[model samples]
Target chain A: MAPSTTTTYTTKQWILASKPTGAPVLSGPDATFKLQTVTLPPLKDGQLLCKVRHFSNDTGLRNFIQSTVAPERFYVPTVPVGSPMRSGIIAEVLESASPSYKAGDLVMDFHLGTWSELVVLEAATSQKLAPLPKNLSLTHYLGAFGASGLAAYTGLKFAGGAKPGDTVVISAAAGATGSMAIQIAIHLLGAKRVVGIAGSDEKCAWVQDQLGAHACVNYKSPTFVEDLKAATPEEVDVYFDNVGGHVLDAMLTRVKKHGTIAVCGAVSGYNSDEPMALRNWFELISMRINIKGFIMLDYMDKAPGILQELIGAVADGRIKLQDAETMVEARIEEQPEVWMRLFSGKNQGKLITNLIV
Target chain B: MAPSTTTTYTTKQWILASKPTGAPVLSGPDATFKLQTVTLPPLKDGQLLCKVRHFSNDTGLRNFIQSTVAPERFYVPTVPVGSPMRSGIIAEVLESASPSYKAGDLVMDFHLGTWSELVVLEAATSQKLAPLPKNLSLTHYLGAFGASGLAAYTGLKFAGGAKPGDTVVISAAAGATGSMAIQIAIHLLGAKRVVGIAGSDEKCAWVQDQLGAHACVNYKSPTFVEDLKAATPEEVDVYFDNVGGHVLDAMLTRVKKHGTIAVCGAVSGYNSDEPMALRNWFELISMRINIKGFIMLDYMDKAPGILQELIGAVADGRIKLQDAETMVEARIEEQPEVWMRLFSGKNQGKLITNLIV
Candidate 1:
């Protein structure tokens, strides 16, 4: 809260120290972040100050730093060097000079520079999240009910055109968006079978046993293709592709006639300089598959309805919030390390760093 | 006409002699066709005998021969070696035993073996075209009123979703379907600027001057990309792609956001053992371009309506059958050579063979 006394607050943030050479690491000569503190300026007439509660890590952050040479090339606004990293965050208002936001207001900023101890913005910029239900945790607001959740839901509904009894497959099935996509395919869309592609046996087990998916395959396993085939004998009707590359190619070969691929992310190639060589692209014509690449920004108008349905499903237990059970939590200082877990496949479920206790 | 005497009739046909080593040749070690003769069998119940009047040469004929080793892979059935070459044909009924047809009837058979002087089939197997309109020739039934016409119309209307004022570009713009596509995009679809990509300057001139396309680019020129850029300053809104190789890749770079690419054919790769390397396929996701590869067989139910509209357009001079001017007429015995003109980009317009005349 702002004090009448001449007291000032300083904000700590993780800035883009340098571009990563390849896949990012927390402690290396090629490390891509630097921590810094800045003195907060007086609140402007339309400005509001927020204390970051929790912010979600995204593979897109890697793309942001690497894509700085051509920020306009990406869908989202890229974070400039020396600027605090941009991310989706759930935050509490600490001070407000605007009529729209008051102290203690919980807001979700999809475009905010949130890998920091504090965020200050015009009240109109961020969306005030609805009050959390008693049964659902605030993590749901960041994972299953936030941008990642909306990505999974909209990508399936709009891109994949998820229908009842469709055999849906999700890559990166242990990640925040993929896990939600797996459950959405089953509970909301009534998919006949759901296959999850993860990177480890533990993640695969959790994806299958904890998430109610029909099967889960470790993509790192030698029998990855065989396992995927065995799991989806009828062939995939909707492939919610989060990890594009070899996984996308494999699904392309197996997609049923008129199947759709919801390309939400390409995590596998975000760190690489070369565009992945896709062999099975010809199948896009052969099987008459529809490959739609989309971002949540394109589906903002549909977000409210999707969020409502997702919240209702999670509350009614139709959607098991398995991401909460295996949650990976870290402090604001560990943002780089926690985010690295996403790239290294060490993170379990939704990876978030708590900026405030 | 049936023979007045009880003399037996022998039908001459072109049969698949052997698979081509590469692109087929009419007279070489790589010759893919052979001439054969067989006595016409007596008409059975519900059967009719017809003499092939004119047969259309399609780029798909190349795929048919190449796909024979694995016939099930292609959308249409493949022709076996030693069997008559199959194609779309306009024929005249010589005799009939079914009530559906009678002697002297004009029929259109999409799946008939047309590289022959005669064909016999059940009356239900072919559609009896109405009496030829006074303003139209028999070639109209095989071009503007037949499968190629439907391919162009359906590709632009259904697959491309071509709309008024859209900047439509058609690859292989001097070929059969592309020629019609150029006109349909301008006259029917009301595209503001239609760009045609042909292989030669003469063909490009005909595409722009005769076919009413706003501009035509000779793709074989070393400055093809620059020429295409100069021609389509506003960029492409709908690309009716008949050639899928470097040209398709080039178009992908110039396509407007949310453009549609109707994959009608890939003549560049038909005879080559190597799959054309496509580098810009990622644009399919970035631009949210819809790339649909289709066969006319999928839209046969809509063929009649398309044919009716096309016939009206032809008669009204709305679609300049300018293609009729450059028609490549070949004897039935020269089917192999005429078909090579499709891959070689030597045929000017709708390539057809005179079977009876």
Candidate 2:
């Protein structure tokens, strides 16, 4: 789409109303977000006015919106109580104040809030991207070729020391990072066996059949424990953990000697008032296992190179990512419900909301 | 002391009678050990007939005497119901068929059962030591220059990555391994501040005053947690955990980013039927801590050189072990009571039983 013809522009944003109690509220009388409309101010040099086209509904905002965090416990700054929520979005460069971008050019803003329909981005944070048809999907920049992809690549390389012929077990296999991890483990890293743990039977089937995982176990199933055992006859060498809790404890009992557990996220514990207490920590000593946690921003220096590698891999059909992307057509007002899809396990693969009509 | 001069010498041995219900029973009706008497046999071509002079009473016997262990959870072989309990000992060779050892030579046996007054050792397992004045104390070999010493040295080197000016916190600071760890951390590893955790005020004083630790905290004190906090104001760089459970949970909250917890021993949980649960596991991810468990046998190849280094250090007055060697004199029948002192906190430093008289 072309830039809007109107000379004046206004946008609606969801601002934080109160500190969260337990989980963040998406709707109703107790909703944490208060809707506000604001007129755009004159853009400064080295800035671009962008209209958000597609935005990722992710758990990143949940980590930063908390009232207070211990200095050592958090990696990023906490979102102020009245500030607009932030997310990753693909936006169109409309009425650029900077010489680097022109009108109608598409860009990816990894952290700029898409709660507003129109956002002003500094040149430093805005990444110029190739337009549609030449690129696989605008959503791909926010999903496979973005932060999710970088986490999967580096978590394995640095923490797990992923090598050829290794057996990897990935949790939250239907989610963004886990799905990418499965493909990277099998296709790029040459893992001998790749087993995935997902939330539902349909998600398991898609993970195994579509994402090329050797085996996929539905964690919701009654026989999930038995199924996981049957899937990996060879013990797990690297466990890429996305949803920590009972899954981490279970993997603790199943890892090979000197195995590595790369903790990418803890979706299972993020919203709970009390995070799960792991009882099998002694296994760390008994098994000589090494478990590590990582945030994506830590590896941004290596992102551009890996993003090109991922783009080339997808362009050459070396890695399959399209089948794993689950997108929804939603405007700015529908983001709260779209983000809710992640908690309900209703979204398959990477959940992206398309704002374009 | 001279070798036993009886032609037909009879030896008393303690054999495991039954599986331990919780902690092994000593001298009661439900005692796990049964006494046996056997006449000494002639030495074989590759064996030595040795008179056990001094035996180290250690926690090593507790792990193997259990009826069964999960294959993945255990490193050493489990002692069958009727087998003798083994420990490290310093002994005098009475007769030898192998050319490597001769009559009256002192040797250290790291794994041979000293539940007997007399025993046979394979030429392969026996380590010949230098005669009296050339060696510091016969008990020193069992205390700081033996398995305990090696565990401290290697646990720091490989697991904790002990470096100059590191703030290393050691638990069980009055016990054999922990005392040596304090010396190794300060003198050898060049630790800037070493805080020791011991079971009693006296032990803590010895750890601080005698072992040259910067500070020492009594874990039994009512204000232990606060004392520990006051002791480690700079925060812990490496925690040498000899006692697990709440101490582990407490230290989990104190470690600096990228700090290590070398799980050398878990004396707090060894005899309990159910091990204590650790609730602060999320700290591992939040603090990015690396906690590892290691055994001395894993580094036997490097033990000889480090043992020589320990001997030289103690000899040159750089490391102190003289105040830490606690000795007991009793016949073979007193083994169970001596072992119980370790659990009751009655024994301090390196408890060695002298069979010289």
Candidate 3:
């Protein structure tokens, strides 16, 4: 592949047109993310212009919108309309003005309002990507070794207190973050039991087979609580809460004394006007459980260490990265539909929107 | 006064009447604790016959009739119908067959059931009282230096994570345990600010004045939330929660990041058939708070150390013990009315029925 030059090019971009209502629609009064043609912004002296190859659609972005429902309850606004939608992206640097990188360097940058072909990111915010190891695909880095991987690592390490012989239960177990957490708990931390609670029987099998989980229970089962109780008879030591609602409440009821709950995202209530009633929260006091909610942006300092460990794990086959690649080379008008597919649980793994091929 | 050698004295005793409905009435539907005159049970080789001097009434005693509640949840259960009521008491050893204690020695024992004039206790359960310091009253030892003192010390030390400059908030601040916790936080731990949340204006004032609380708020006020917010703008660092319904819910909203909440009791919900609803528990995750429910019995190993520290503080006048002494010297049949006073909140401090004058 030949290296490309830094050229000012006009590309179609999607901008948040409206705030979302309950269960965001593809096109509605709540959201109208419109596609428009705009000139690529010029890179500053310490910035780089990169061509975004893969853009991420994640549960956190959905939560970012609902956090604004009750502004006083949250520390910050969820997401603002008329702004570039926040995302994580893997891009190739075409132009660099900073000492950190050159024209042909590939980097993982979070300046991914990357519903676009080109993004101008500051060198400080742009992370130079290490060469993908043999047999590892570039899309794997965007999913498992990128922001999602680091989030799982730090969340389990700090909040989950992942330790040997512990039982870790993860919601949304088939998703990038949850799958990463399951692998980290089992392979890295020597967890005795890694249980996954997913939405379907297929995801349950994937979590157990592909992610190396000891057991996986479909939370959609009418007998979900009984199955979870049977699966985790010793009670969960660490709960990696991703889809927080009834699953979270059920998990709380089964947490062992002095257990830790890592609240990564609340996908179940993300688009709802009313937040789910967590009836079992009183268990927190009785069981001495520590439930901590966090955003990965707060732990940016640990990113390098996380990426190194993840890459090493993948290369050694201790961790498997399953990239659910959905290549979309369509016009910008189809962006909202692509993003909405994530909420429908159609994507088995990381839902990456490939802007160019 | 010289001690008498006669251990065969007959005394009238109150047996557990039928349990009452709603607020326990003096007269029960089954049988008001009948006046029973029986021969005293013989003391065993390792037991002492303790002539009950004072029997304390606490909110925990109410849980006995509710068999559905956990045995570990309360201090003692109401006496089973026709059985002697169990309680904590200050008694004098009238006769002893144990090497651990001598006849005529004053002792504090957990077998209060002092609705009777005599009770038998094992030597291991009774602590021989030091000669009451000329400056310290024996009643004060029973009130502050007994279980209440140990509860405060343990709550602050283990559960509250209390440090020198941390702000400590105590609920039910005028009650025996809350008052003791306030003094321990302020004087023993050197907390920067000790706030007390009490039920009445007078009790709030007493918490600040007698217990050395930095400030006190009456939670009964319509502006309790605002008043509490104004009182604790820095946010609560340690909350020793005794009354756990609305007070705990309100405190949850104002707890600082990484704060510790010691869930000592849920007196507010003790009598309610429906559990209190706490809607803002999501703050626990956002603030990274640690809320733990504890029973002093769980930390009994630290009892001797707690007693030494608390006794020294009380003797030195660093910690003041306020005696909410509602003296009742009545016949055994009057026990029901005495027990009823505690539920009405009519008793100021420790409600003790003085069997001896």
Candidate 4:
């Protein structure tokens, strides 16, 4: 009954070696990440070993790295210097000592320190993903059908109050959450108009063409203000902000009376020490705008229901699975370079790293 | 029956000859106000002539004067160069040409250009007060039983959502609206702790001692920040902000999660061309505070019911009418100086002008 002794397994992980003062340069000697290889331990009772098939690169990692500084700490704690950098992961159970998981069973883990070829976790840690139905990839669980999708659903439903015929403006529209938000607003919420703000022309094009957003404004354009104005002819009814700072200020002037703004992320200021000054904040009084800060961790209870709805939508073709136009693939060893794409806006859709390479 | 001839009535008015570049100086040759004498016009059908008794000096008049600047205009129109300055007035009917009114009827007239001694109005233009009930003075209609009282009632009930055990902070807490707000928060809403922010120690003392607020912080003191911090040991629940700017910034940092800020006015910026920057606006996101701008004009429909409750509270011993410790008195001729006292924070309690002098 002993397992085959011929093959041995080793795990490779990217550990946080130092705290970053600014944006982390992944390839330098002073890089924040350090790669390490180690032998796998025998599975303990109530534990399972998973081969992390895909790593979900996220902009929130910027906040994670800064958590070492208490005053500047964000909503959550950072990955320790000697531990694996944390992220959402799509994995398959390779070995199991728990009754809940068996070999070859797939799962989705959220913030379980996932930047590794193989990770051992307590059986209670991750949700067991059902078999990947037709037209859905294993990577979809880390994106369109996962936490980001649930956030888009909850934020738009409760915070944005997105309704039929509403004009919704979403920042970071080509990123993971934004892509899902745009599709949900258009296909599910029946939004009359959806305008997106993205950094590059290609990303903007993908956001408009693939995600079915009505318009996409390149935030890097020289005529960004004018483009934004043209994109939103009428006052905006709901604003889903991801990249805050000047974009938020510009939208403050554009939100209609009694409009709502869902503050999802502020990636623009994550790298800077100084918080940007919002000059037109008085408009919050004049226009009666309601701005609410949102975090997905607070709404975990709604995830099961939201994920169910998303899975059905994806399967029935109501939500186009191809909406994610680009899935940039990289080897597990290339995670440092791949993650930089998230902050640099180089990834078109979701960025997934393959563990097999 | 022919009425015996009596003393002729002459109307005194203050007209705005030019727009102010900054705060209007009343005594200078380039004064914003110009006093004029005019003969009383004959009352037309459905018209009544009233002698104005008391003029209500409100900071909102600052916005009224600003109406000439098209885009920045307040809820109503401006007092044109040839017209008398506008204000809420208490008046007695001297002559009636309509069945609805008769001689000696007391009434409250809103925006009736009270900077004059005698005025003619259509019978339908004013709310005729019931016969002078005991424990009520003519001045009460312009103060505790007037617009400010109604504002405090509705603002606390809805905008601020003040309730029992709620710790409330009222900025400009010794002024007309603020004084009423303090009493309403303490007596009506049963707020556990009420803090007042006033300009001087005398005003602060009166606000605390007479208005029944738990604590008062003089914003003019050298240790204002420490004083405010000591006054509010816990995160504030409801902040009734009347003076917005630095005070608003300070409160933004101290507000608890889901706190509500009723932004009734921004007195600090009324005289300045530049709007002050809210540096801690990000707190709106982190704390999830809701800041609502309230204009009483929008809530006119709620006035009748609210005024009835306020009048009853004043008639009973529940609300002390003598709570206004400093009712700064001024002669009708010193209207310009009295109005200037409002902007300079020289007046305590409500600023009332006696028309007979």
Against the unseen true structure, what C-alpha lDDT does each candidate score?
0.78, 0.79, 0.74, 0.77
TM per prediction:
0.84, 0.86, 0.80, 0.80
Q: Whole-model lDDT, candidate 3?
A: 0.74
Per-residue CA lDDT of candidate 1, range A263-288, in tens? 88777777766555554555665666
Fraction of native contacts under 8 Å reproduced by each candidate: 0.24, 0.27, 0.19, 0.24
Worst 10 residues of 2 chain B by lDDT: B67-76
Q: Pick the winner on lDDT between candidates 3 and 4.
A: 4
Count steric clashes of candidate 2.
0
Give the winner by TM-score.
2
Best candidate (score: DockQ):
2
lDDT of 4 by residue, B1-357 (tens): 998554446787777766566687676777788888888767779877898887888887776665223333234565666667888887889998899999999878885645887887778878887643574666767777777777777777777889899999998988888899998898878899999999999989988898888999998899987889899988689998888878887787776777888877777777666545555655665566777766666678988887777777767766776756345456677877776778887667677776665
| Candidate 4 per-residue C-alpha lDDT over A1-357 given as tens digits, one digit per residue, 9 for 90 to 100 | 998664456888888888787788676788888889977777779878888877877787876766322332245555767777888887889888899989998877875746788888777878888766784676787788776787788888777889999999999998888989998898888899999999999989988887888999998899988899899988699999987788887787778777888888777777666555555555665666777766776678988888888888778877776747355567777888878877776766666776666
**Better model by lDDT, 1 or 2?**
2
Candidate 4 chain B has its poorest 10 consecutive residues by lDDT at B66-75
Which window of ten consecutive residues has the lowest lDDT sum in model 1 chain A? A67-76
Query: Candidate 4's error at B31, in angstroms?
Result: 6.5
